[model samples]
Target: MRAQRKGPRRRRALITGSLGALVFALLTVNILLGSYTVTIPDFLAMLGGRTIPGASFIVMETKLPQALLGLLAGASFGVAGAIFQSMLRNPLASPDIIGISYGASATAVAAVVLFGVRGAGVSVAAIIGALVVALLITVLARGRGGTGLILIGIGAAAFMQAAVTFLLSRADLRNAQDAMVWLSGSLNSANWERVAILAVALLFLLPLTAAGSHQLHGLTLGDDTASGLGFNVPRARLLLTIVGVLLAALPTAAAGPIAFVAFLSGPIAKRLNGGVASLHLAALVGAAIVLAANFAAVNAIPGISLPVGVVTGALGAPFLLWLLISSNRANQGG
Candidate 1:
């Protein structure tokens, strides 16, 4: 039996690793192949600290930063999804499902339209808004069932959606159109400075995730059990909530809440790895999905570009509905 289990595990590891490598290589090629094709030799020489004037600026300005955003956003969404699913003990408890992205989007849009805030200020507002909604959901669901929390999150998300609709209705036509674009995610206009900001967040969050891995494992048990295990359950939860909100918020701020990457990454990783629980695997899968999706979004069609959010939503919405249906059936049978 052990040998049989080991065989499947080895196969899964090999498959997951192959998938990750292929995704990364494809993303690299896509990044280099856009608009002006920078040959492999020139691209390497440019990165190796030798100046190929136009190539250096193009690499520095365009591909490098966007690639970094894709990486950071993908990793953040992936890890956040894993943490949320584990904490809520529900596969459907991802931030996207719980309306974390909606909260961020609502607040950022409010900032842009009502307050005229831009740049880092928009990001900060989105973070604050997401935290507020997350707290409300947590507080309202305290001492209640996990299903209660899920329901409350849905309500919060709906409220955010309404708010966005209201804002769009009130705005002028051009502004409304622009708002529509943001309501869906886009990474096309990202700059090097945005990349720098996301990198800083990753620098902090990745190490923090490493240190908190043990706590996350404890969380897979019931709260009481986790508390009994010497984990500060409330504090740990608070930290996780903050991490998740920021993870969702930062990307929303930069890329406009690309939907469903956060929702899909954990499950896809689990499925691909045959139920492995490694956060690293989840991150890898998340990065692969985002980069791969972006590559398709950028190059899949001519004369028109689909946003990353659109591609993810196209895939995520149907899957999310299926999940909801499956959960309902299981509950009925139980």
Candidate 2:
């Protein structure tokens, strides 16, 4: 038994270390490749202020902010995904599927369209909207099956999408264009200001994520078991949901729904860890995936850049469909 445990431990350490190294290398490559190519030494010189103006401005004003936002957004999505999956005890129970992302997007869009709010104020509104929707779903789904929650969340997502569509139809062309850009998700407008906002928000919430990680594990044992284990299941659920909402909301507010970082991160971590508890692994994988995707989108093909979300959605949607199909197959087999 001791030998078996030791082997797995060594393997887990190896896997985690490999992933960490790969993510770091990908991030470095991502920082180097963009609209303006910066050689490693030149980039270093720019950072150290030994380079000329043009490359320095491009590096300082553009690539840096985009990279930072991608990292934060990925990390947030990954952690949020793990929380929801553990809490609901379903691999598919991620924020994107549960309407949390839509809830935040809907509110942020409303603020932009109806109230003319922007920036940090829109982020605050988005968080509120997400929490409200999450609370309602939790309340209604209490004592009910996961299927009911899934159905209700689907309905909510559809409604929010419809509302956004209607608002876009009525918007002027310029505003519509802006909304379209947001709808698709872009890091083109990333700036130090947005990076700063994400930094501050993460600083406030990351400690909370760490503190609640153990309770999150308890939740996987089901509500009754968790309660018997002296966990306050309801409060735990509420707090977890709130944290998930905030995590999903901040990036949505900052960069729109950048697709499947949330959906992909946790499951990838689970697969990587051979189905271990996925708190820290999920966040790390999430950051890696988002950063890698952004890098790929910008640098994959010369003169053919795409919205960052496009790559993630293209990859994420298929994974989600496969998950659903496989789940149904398992149910049938059972």
Candidate 3:
């Protein structure tokens, strides 16, 4: 009886711990093993305020912020994706697939390319953009249920992607270069300010998400079941959607919708956790994915540093195809 009671909890803890360790390892690797390697001892010294000539600048300004933002943004995308996927009971319900990330990307591009907005203003535009898209999706899918909402979201994503392309085409070279970051999702511009903004945003947003995540299991059982289980379907779904949008949007604003962090995190975490959906596990998996991808992007070529999104996009495309194939087969089998 005692072992039975502890079995699930033990498995949960083991998986969570393993993922947390992976994220921490990736974070350290991203920080300590970069273009300019900082020996672990020297890295410690630097963290303790002892500057090691050129190493201090690289470590302090570039790798640290880059890795930190990657971790936070990854976690946000992961948790947000997990929320939406669990709530809608569909893998295709990811913020990336359902247009929330693209909505943020489109507005951020427009803010920078058309209005000349920069700095935190772009982040503001991104959050507002995601909210607007979520609202539009809700309105259009009011009577249509989850499938309707998902289809509408996908359409919105296509439109937003086109908008991003169109805006890029109209901008001058300098502006185009800037807008390109949002389009491809680069972490090269990561600075302390950007890191702080994302960190603060998550500090407030994560608690709300954790609170709402409790209802996800109920939601996965469908609207009627959820309501029967005493969950307020509409209100809870609305709150989760708004929170999920902001989670994906703020990160997109900070990092330019970095590929499929939102799309891949939940499914990957579920697989890792023995097919149980754990948002905490997903967040850690997200951090690990981004950090690992960033490390590969930087070291894959001697001189070429690709945008982080490029690597993730390359990886996610194949997975997306596989997911579709496998899902179709399963449906047919059923």
Task: Show model 3 residue runs off by greater than 4 Å.
Answer: none
Assess candidate 2 and give its lDDT. Answer: 0.82
> Per-residue lDDT tens digits of candidate 3, residues 1-334?
9999798789889988888898899999999886778788898898899978899999999999999999999999999999999988888889989888888988988999889998899999999999998899889989998789999999999999999899989999999987786578778889999999999999999899888877877788889989999999888988898888988999898888899888899999998777889899899988888999999988899888889999999999999999899988998995
Candidate RMSDs in Å, in order, are 2.6, 1.8, 1.2
Count of clashes in candidate 3: 0
Top of the candidates by lDDT: 3
Which residue runs does candidate 2 get wrong by more than 4 Å?
1-5
| Candidate 1: tens digits of C-alpha lDDT, residues 1-334 | 9999899779877976887796678668656886657888887887788888787887767777777788778878888888888777788888888888888888888888888787888889888888888888989998887889988999989989999999989887877887788778877767877777877877888888877778888888979999898999888887877887787788888878888888888888778766755677788877787787777787788766678788888889999999989988988995
Q: Scored by Cα lDDT, where does model 3 land?
A: 0.89
Model 2, 19-63: lDDT tens digits are: 778777877777787667788898777778685778777787888
Pairs of residues clashing in candidate 1: 252-257
TM-score of 2: 0.94
Q: With candidate 2 superimposed using the best TM-score fit, by how many Å does residue 334's alpha carbon deviate from the native?
A: 7.0
If scored against the real structure, what TM-score would every candidate get?
0.90, 0.94, 0.97
